[model samples]
Target: MATPGVFLISAFVFAFAAANIGGALSYTRPPPRQTLSVPLADDLDSNSPQQVHVSLVGEDKMRISWITEDRAPAIVEYGTSPGVYGSSAMGNTSSYKFITYKSGKIHDVVIGPLNPNTVYYYRCSLDSSRAFSFKTPPAQLPIKFAITADLGQSGWTNSTLQHIAASNYDVLLLPGDLSYADLLQPQWDSFGRLLEPLASQRPWMVTQGNHEIEKIPVIHPHAFTSYNARWHMPFEESVSDSNLYYSFDVASVHVVMLGSYTDFDPQSAQYAWLQADLGKVNRSRTPWLVVLIHAPWYNSNTAHQGEAESDNMRKLHGRVDL
Candidate 1:
């Protein structure tokens, strides 16, 4: 009973819709890419420094961190020229145990009052003949920062590291999920050695992710055991007692690294610290404020949707002026 023109238009629309539905039903997801694990360096001597990396401390200080099989002095000798040591700073050493795995001696030394935008040559300890060097970030604006997240130990990580190394960035800001050790302590060492080439040359400021929570209930009874022992941030300077959350200033920017896996309720310490930290920020001096968190506050992806961390953080951000 329909008119010929109307019938023809309806048929066309039906066919088009059917074709699109069929295509959608037949769509196949591509296979995931294969990623290889980065092996640990076996060439270095037992006492030789390995996994050497640097991180920013206060305004004019750098924290040199490294691991050695045998106990070594937590000392760093640095100067402008190679092999010409002028000043030295000593720090502390500590290690951790994870189930059956025990970590090597980890040394952390805070060397400082360094000149900005200048390269400084340094060595870990007096016993080592090998030397390494790093360039301090620029003191003022136009400072370049490389932001990375969820960097696991894999072939993809290597490729990413190579790209970051070529970027010549002044500082590196890692949101979280470093190493992806996931309770495997040795993977942390492998990750350190893997990133040392780039991390040593520049400052890598990082925070904790879900993967860093290596707590195993009563068996382990502790969270971030390995992380706390290794990647020590300048939380004390920010008046934060825990290393999980902290803030630092570089150039004209102030960066706040928040811990998404930790407690962030209204009555939590992290929440209180965040409120105080933001209150103390002087926007006049620091024109730019950058905040980093592992769990995204806004994500369209179906995965990790409606997670408590993301939900609470999003709500919290709405309350804050930032």
Candidate 2:
């Protein structure tokens, strides 16, 4: 069941819990990275497509995003059946140049008017890539979601993904700290490959966390350049001008993904958006309202002790129970 609350511990806590549950078996070796098999021609070597994933843009709509080593045309052929692409959508492509490196080209395509609860087949090509399939969210109530936070490309990640796959989640919500790339650009590539199994098949909605603040002193001092370029959330539909905070709907639930690392003060833009968003939520349509943030305003964790903004939020919204 999905509960409305704060996540004090990060993704690593889940990994450690799994280890404890397995007893001595927990000492077993971590699983190897999963890979998809494709023909040599489809691989396209350096220019091959990678890190392909999907995000829910709105009702009957989805966003497919991917990364490529070189600039190329981005197109997605998708339909309800394998090898029978009946529809196609063309979207924008961009690349980020930071410090001494220029990141790979990123592509995002939004496809829409899809039938709810149906499986869709897709093949993305920047150069050449394999086909993948995904099932849309159900039209009615009872949507299952899998959520994890602060994910880095570590050995424990393999096991965590196995558990998520077994759960049969309709969507995945990562609140923050994806890849933990810090400043190592290659780590982002590796992390994307690691998450393909779950992310490629379902919408992976995320919010920025502190770890994503890859600020290079005296060089590339801007924040969220990589995160913004890759994960294109549908903030525009919700009237939010920032990717750091946005909301989406699935089934009867309205999910609000917030950025704890960004400004959340009473006078900040995010706070204003938060108030307006919550005020407009039609409980008659979406009965459940769930909030996700990387850092809790009231967490007992010593590392974040004496946090202040959560108090402001509590005062702003008043005491209420889910």
Candidate 3:
């Protein structure tokens, strides 16, 4: 016969064993198989100039853009020296820090106040291997320009860019979604290289698109953050301190950019600034007026949902939207 203390100890040991066995059985089940996605770059390319395109800004201004995989600050070198006018335009450099982008900002450097009826030369670089050269539009009056939106770098999209180039427009006004950054970086890199031909020749005036917004935090560096760093737009020329929302005057046009992401009240800073800017514009200098913003005021789809916040803004333009 066992002593009382021994019996108690034996009973405790049995209970512990039972619990352990039960716990083990519960945890042995297999987990679900929903795998995470991986970025799709099996091969890496060298840091070379890609997506080179040109846009006509004004009579004296042009925008040049390119991309590199260097993951470093971008640099540009050119001057009026012999063998150097096609890429000429000594300006401050802009860096690309957004990882969300496979490439960097489109280096929309301005080569402007250029001599009328003159050609210029220039080169773009990352560090070891990002060198590219291109020419400028001939200075002339009644200059022609191409304008559009939703341009991309792949899938026979070259045809669209080719059409723009063939027009030989002095300027290109792209209001939204220049290249789809929402796709992976490779797509953006392709778009970068695709535009080189057009960007090198004319000034491409641009705004932003909904696709440009950054949803992830890690990619903030590349998120339209690169946009701010790369393009030297004359946003400051507008009453607003930001080019993301500002206005500039071309020969006979007053162009304004609105921050469609936020609520816009006539009393808002940008609204007040627009009022002042428009008030100041001499109708004689710029007779035409146009507004550029990402969101549409009204559309039929609504995508068809109802929300008070969206409804308030819809009142500005319309309830239905694009």
Candidate 4:
């Protein structure tokens, strides 16, 4: 016969031994945790025009956006004197912003009055040889430009962009759906790094696309938080900075950027604001009026099949006659 206290102690010792054995076995073989990396890549090759593009941000002003393959300081050398570009030159150093967990820096350089239609030589680089140039289009001239969406593509998609680029144009406007973000962090980083060329040379203006919508997985939150966060668009005060929606004067044209993802319905603040904005366009000063929205209301593409909300807003602004 054993004392109750002694028996209790013996039982406790046995349990402790069993627990230690279990712990040892578990330590020897345990499940692994999956780790992820924020994606960023070597920018486009140093000074090479990876995604060279241009946009007329305003009268006498051309915005150029491009990419480099490396993380280096930016150097844009330009001048009205063609052969004397590097000499008697107007030099402006620029910067590239790499978003959190994303790769590559977004670079912008604005040049102006460009002799209207004269051939102006220019070059852009950072940390090295970003040599490039182009002739600015003449002012008050009817210009042809390419428009597309779902860019920031890889090699295959890049081929498509190249196809579009083959056509000469005064400006390039990308409405949205740039990266085709599929919840992979590295893909996002690579996308930014790759587009440096086009973004740098051209204005490469854009709106938040469907891919810009944030999500935890393939499901559907369809939120624009990620897009809004990464971009430094003027959506508040300076024309188009506060919310990716604003008005700007481009030569004789009045351009309006609308925020379809946000509230643009009659009851929303954006709707009222836009009505007020369009009301004041002063058609006399700006002859041609244009509207840019991520999701166009009337498109044959099934992806935009039922964009009823955007359709409604577009109808409200029928002045464009769509």
Candidate 5:
């Protein structure tokens, strides 16, 4: 006969083992979906703007970003009504080279001390036929944000975009894993063209993910070389030295986007900036504080378990309320 304490210990061990076996048996993953590549418009002229998207600049400004195959002026003309030009803004253009791939001229123009909640028609370069319009976010509360993540170019991505478009959300928050180009540079252009339809009309704020880090050991040693050149976030406006992380405000909400792929150690610039950014936030003005990070601090999924980024970031939870 076993002692009472020994019997209890034996029973506890049995139960724990049974639970682990049960969990493992129940876990199942669905089949992978087919990948789809969205092609560029066949009718677009060489100088015509393609992959046009917009992002919020400061409080009253919007940054219009697009790509052109040939040399095109980085100019944007805009007004409240369609086909009417009341204001114009000039901006800069740049391109990047990845391995043997050379990108088209990328243009970014910041427009307006725009009115909140009002629609503004805009044309890129000198083309009136390619006119696009976007509504600025409201000045007050009750704002809706359509949050999404891991938006690789696929058939599923198309469905997701359609669902988001019908939702009528004010802004879109993407925590990372965009494009999934993974060093195939042309895929980035394809992804941009796919996103232009929705991203053009609304502000899409995003952070960097592991997929964005297309670093090769000898040939291409740099990380985020492609991503930094393409998705230009308002990092400078927030006084952030790197484009990997930044903060922005929409209505009564304050959003901070953190980079999981970047250095997040306590001694790193990202960690230091996060402390200062959170400290500067006025809780009275922006009632809600939302932080976006690529890797989750706590996750039940088996794929990305026990990551250093997640562990290190979780440690800061006690130091900061976030």
Candidate 6:
């Protein structure tokens, strides 16, 4: 025989406790696995294609790049649908030489005249392993892109990938310092595999960073040998002599990716090209001009304090805009 007020209070307390417990049980959890459908290291050690990625070559053309344990022809069979690849294209492959290890075969093929803003499916091999799909950028305004730099292999990198995948961005612009492969070559392969799920699904346009300049002493002191071998950009199409710098346009946005590690003085080739590229930009077509470089011209970081690229660029009519 409890009082009416006591009975009501007791019921209310019970309901509150039950609701909190239910809420706790319903909390969302991240997946136990690292990345979706990521193959084991053993699978990547052979001729199997690893670190497969895509890049936009033109309005109607796309390039697919991958690495293999051995030299193989760059073959890509693509069409508007999966398993129905009525078209096939073959390209070339190249390898990079290090002091100890010779890198696997790097393959690249530019396939073209694809339907705008449509989801296209393709297989990399003549004996295709897994079919991948990518959507061409729409020929209209409001293009969405995700840009980041210095993405070394770590747990944070894993989380970043998961977030990027969920966002469904149209393009990925990595200014520089990708993989942090530095001297250790195996990390490059690992980085590629980790990025496959996201990069394979979108265009990952990149430029060289200081880290990419892995200059080995004694045997091979040359720079960018490994970086140049792995990442093949469409600089040639843009009439640029070096892949170290290039520009591309998507919708109303024109992106200029510069090489901080390369020459940027007034008399340098890059500076001259930059001037010509800027002069040719039609504001009517591309209203927004965006520039990306690994080292910020106006950065306050003490690590790169001695660098005066920002000041030098300004003197040469290269203004930094946020």
Best by lDDT: 5
lDDT per residue (tens digit) for residues 80-152 in model 2: 9778888999999998876777888898999978888889998887333477889998976778889888667
Model 3 — which ten-residue stretch has the worst lDDT?
6-15
Q: Compared with the true structure, what per-residue lDDT tens digits does model 5 show for residues 205-237? A: 888888999999999999998889889999999
* Full-model lDDT for every candidate: 0.81, 0.77, 0.52, 0.52, 0.83, 0.76
Question: Where is the poorest 10-residue window by lDDT in model 5?
Answer: 6-15
For model 6, how does the per-residue alpha-carbon lDDT over 189-237 read when each residue is reduced to its tens digit?
Answer: 7788889888888889999888999886877888888788888888887
lDDT of 1: 0.81
On TM-score, the leading prediction is 5
Candidate 2 ranges beyond 4 A from true positions: 1-44, 126-129, 303-322
Off by over 4 Å in 4: 1-55, 64-75, 81-105, 125-128, 152-159, 188-202, 215-243, 267-269, 298-322
Worst 10 residues of 4 by lDDT: 6-15
lDDT of 3 by residue, 76-103 (tens): 5555553443444433434544443333
Q: How far does residue 22 in candidate 5 sit from its true spot (Å)?
A: 14
* Deviation from native of the Cα of residue 250 in model 2, angstroms: 0.7
What is the lDDT for 138 in model 3?
Answer: 43
Clashing pairs in 5: none
Order candidates by TM-score, high to low: 5, 1, 2, 6, 3, 4
